[model samples]
Target: MGGKQGPQHPRTPRRRFDIMSRYWTFLLVLVRVILPLKAEETSACPADCACLEPQHHILCSNASLTSVPSILAEGTLELRLDYNNLTSLDTGAFLGLSQLSALHLSYCGLRNIQPGTFEDLHSLEYLHLDNNLLESLEEGTFRNLSRLLYLHLENNKLTFLGPDVFQPMDKLSALYLSHNLLTELSNQTFNDLPQLRWLYLNNNLLSNISIKAFAGPRRLRKLSLEANNLTSVPRALRQASSLQSLRLSSNPIRQLGSFGRKLRSLTELYLDELGLQEVSSTSFAGMRRLRTLSLRGNQLEILSLPLLGAQTELLLSRNPWRCDCRLLWLYVHLQVMKSKVSQGEALCSTPTALAGQRLLNVELQKLTCPAFGSHLTTAAPYKVPTYSATTAKRTPPQVMETPKTTTRTTIVSLATKATQPPPVQHPVPASNAVPERWDPCLAELISKVAVRPKGEGALMVTWSTIGEHDQVEVRYSTGEAVQVLWVTGELAEVELNQLHMDTDYKVCIIPLSKHVAQCTNPNPTQCAMSHTSGWGGHIQPVHMQPTPSHSALGTGVAVAVLILVLVALVLAGAYKLRSRQAGFQRHFDEDGFESERYNPDPYKLDGVYESNEEDRKIFVTAASQWSTEDEDKLDCRLATSPTVLSTPRYVTL
Candidate 1:
């Protein structure tokens, strides 16, 4: 048995070999991995600081340090030295931090930043110098930071900024310069920043802004000029055709001037607390796409109702609104808007009947006032729908322009069947009010209009009715109020007298449509009918006011109609000729796409390449990974500490 190997003895060598191999692996990990990590932590990070791994983001906030530490890692991407005592920055202070992408130096009592301080930070994107005592930045202070995006200089003591101080940061987007002491904004102040989107100049002492102050940043979206000394809409804003949200509140402005056509893209406009009174006829003339108009805390008694278009999120709180017949249109508008509103301070500070009550709480017919002037344009008493006792709670939803000279929201007349319409009531007319040109009232109604002399001052008007109706109303706006003359028989005609020789009117006939039940039905399929009680289409209304020489006027109109037909034919021929020539000239596109001339993909993307800035993560495809690190995951979250705001004069500090 000793000479021959037993079953247990044969496995001794193999088990010993396994134990030795495991021991060698443990020694290797301690020497190469664990020891090196400890050494690197001590050498790379400064004392009294926290260093995040992989990205090398150093957080030295609230450490009470007096100066910057010299031993910093070259691969550091972000450095937070906020809440320290770095009173000033010298030239080339961060010379070795070439890879730094974001530097937070806020609340450091920094009074000055010398030139060439950030000259080596080529990869810097966001720079925070807010909550400091920075009186002025030396010219070319940010010499080489070309990739900078967001710059925070708010809550500082900066009194002026050189025109080319930001010339190196062409890609900057959001700039916060609010709560500073800037008294004036010169030409080319923002000329070098074409990609700038959000600009904050609020809470400054800026009483003057040059015509070219906002000239360069054509794509600027959000601009805040609130609490500044500006008294009017800056003309420099005219160049910003892509401007969307503009804040000009609390500026002591008393009047609103012309908003040129270039501001048509403005969506949210804040004119609150301006104590405004006089508004030009064309104050909001070109803002066709305006969605939000806040007139809070303004000293105004009336505003043109036509200014309120569809889908508008209007804010009219804290204002003295006159809720009368002229303003009844607004009450109807609010009802239609339903829940897409935030009128926090919306209350009536007007006529004794509606005083101190919410506008929505008042009844529609109770909002009565005097006649409307011809200077305005808006809607009149539209077709009123009577709800059943339970229908008010069950009303589902509801969802037009009248004449320009006389604005009246009236619809088509249905030919009378049995009963005559009720007599006209003397109330406020929508003489100055009209719906938008594309409003449902006129767009669906005016197929034919007939008018002739019925008496010395009266004219007989007739229109095509929609359906047989027990009651029909001849809706016309030729007097102080929207005149509703009842037609007795099947003919849709009524003679309306000219109370004054005013040049304005449109024949809009509103038929008493049937009751449209808008209740919450358990079966949605059975209640598929629309929640509306009127017609909607695209058409033009007739305006037939007789001239002094009735005979010659008829002949001239015939000649004018013939000329218009000839011009239309000529224009069509020219367009066809030009299109054929352009098609022959087209061969290929920049994208190497081939298609029939004048024809492309439905999205028009077959022949063009647009890397839209709004598209997130949209890019061209790549075959190889040049670098392992993805910048999209970079830690760019800003600190959420309480920002220092210069309190308004009314509040006790």
Candidate 2:
């Protein structure tokens, strides 16, 4: 009750009036508590424009505002101060903007972001300060923005940036610092940004980088350093194992080995227009997981076999190459690897011998090595014949000194000589008639064939020449093919068995113009027709045809012993004859062998037995004197000999 029944019936009206007043007061308090009070929008500006949308938001973009308006408060959650002529952001300008979440200062003439410029914006999550004249960043400038997640500093004139620019932004995920003048980065700069994911450092003047410049933030997945002045890819970036794409196409690194080790994890590599030569096997060895490699527009002489790794598509166009046997080997190897060699214009770079030759045009199987001299050394594991005086007499088509003294006799088989077929003379094409041609058979034959002598006085020719050859030039592949024999005719019978055995070779008669007249038909189609005795003044059948020396083992031993005995006998005969002559001449005085005489005939008297007393005296005196002894006794000389025998003068006197 109403004040205990309204202070009695008489004062009831007064009590009721007082209670109503109290109720009205209570209602007034309730109204003050529940009523919606509006926050002040920026009313200091023009009436037609909306500067501050709410108590927490303000968009002053292109607002003709020179500096920050004073209406902003600590509760502001977003601000757009872009496109302004402001050259610098003053510290404490946003002092009370603690709730600011998005701050866009893009295209502002912000030459510098002073320390504590954004210190009050603790709730800031997105910051866009792009298109500014910022040359440097002060440390701890953004220390208060702990919740900042996205930071864009692109299109700035920043030459060097401090590591602590983003130090407070622990939850930052994307940081774009592109289009800057940064040359290098300091290690541990990115260590604090553990949750950083996307980092764009492209379009900067970065030339070199420290090893651990980007060491931290293992959770970072995407990093781009493209369009910088990086001559070579940094080894530190290879530690970014999660990296998927790397573009190093426009750098000056030439050798493939320089980057092979660092790019083992890269799946896509762009190396276009880089200089390269013969890439060694170790270059691409570690990049086993690599799938795409771009090697377009490089200086390569040959595509090496070892360069072709498994499951790789090689792009080797626009390069120089030496299309020879080695290239042929490479071509065959590539085909076996099943990796397509792209860029078809990759022809032989040799403009002279291999001009306009496409790699596809050459038949690898038909590729023949150029003619190498027989005297050349080879590393192949086969015993090739070596030239010597004794081995020279066995080879046919004798070519050596004294062409006229040596003879070549051609004896035709009396019966086959009449029935032999004429030599087939096919017209060879001008192109094919060149010194060299692309013929597979010739190549195979040269690689697999060997030549040697078969028997005494017989030259054996064995070869597998499947392809057409105008005339096979058969010479002692290794030794001199000439024979020194005593046969006064166009042909001579020499010995054979000089060639290496179990070897294939192509053998045909080469004309000997110096020793014989030119025959109408020198070599016939078949070997039998050409080898008929001495058809073309070659040699006798027994000598021209290779007859393997068929000596039994015992016979060979006996022959060797006979040769030794013959040599011994000749030496003994010469010795005995010399001894007998010496003995017989010794009896004759003047005619005998002269011994050095002490006294010559002219020095002695003819008839008288001359006394050599004076000579003997001089001889004894000279023999008794020694150089040192004489010098020591220089003062003593007193001995003389008398008449009969030069007796001791001192004793007989």
Best by lDDT: 1
lDDT of 2 by residue, 193-312 (tens): 888878888779888788877677766666777677777668777556555556565556667544423444556666666676656533554454556667678787656433233445
Q: lDDT per model, in order?
A: 0.66, 0.56
Candidate 2 lDDT (Cα, 0 to 1):
0.56
Kindly report which residue stretches of model 1 are placed more than 4 angstroms away from their true locations once superposed: 1-41, 278-281, 342-345, 370-653
In model 1, how large is the Cα lDDT of residue 337? Answer: 67
Query: What digit string (tens of lDDT, one per residue) describes model 1 on residues 1-653?
Result: 76575677869999999999999999998889878887975677888999886778999999898888877888899999999999988886776888899999999999878888889899999999999998887779989889999999999999998888988888999999999999999997899999999999999999899988888887899999999998888888888889999999999788787666577678899999999864542377446467788888888765554333445666878778767665655676677665866656458776655688777777776665332111222244333334669656534323124344653433222243124323223343554343332222321323355655443445566555332221233444433444444344555566566533323444444432111111111121111111111222233456798777996988999999999999999999999778756655555453355554454444446434444545544322111111111222323333221122111111110
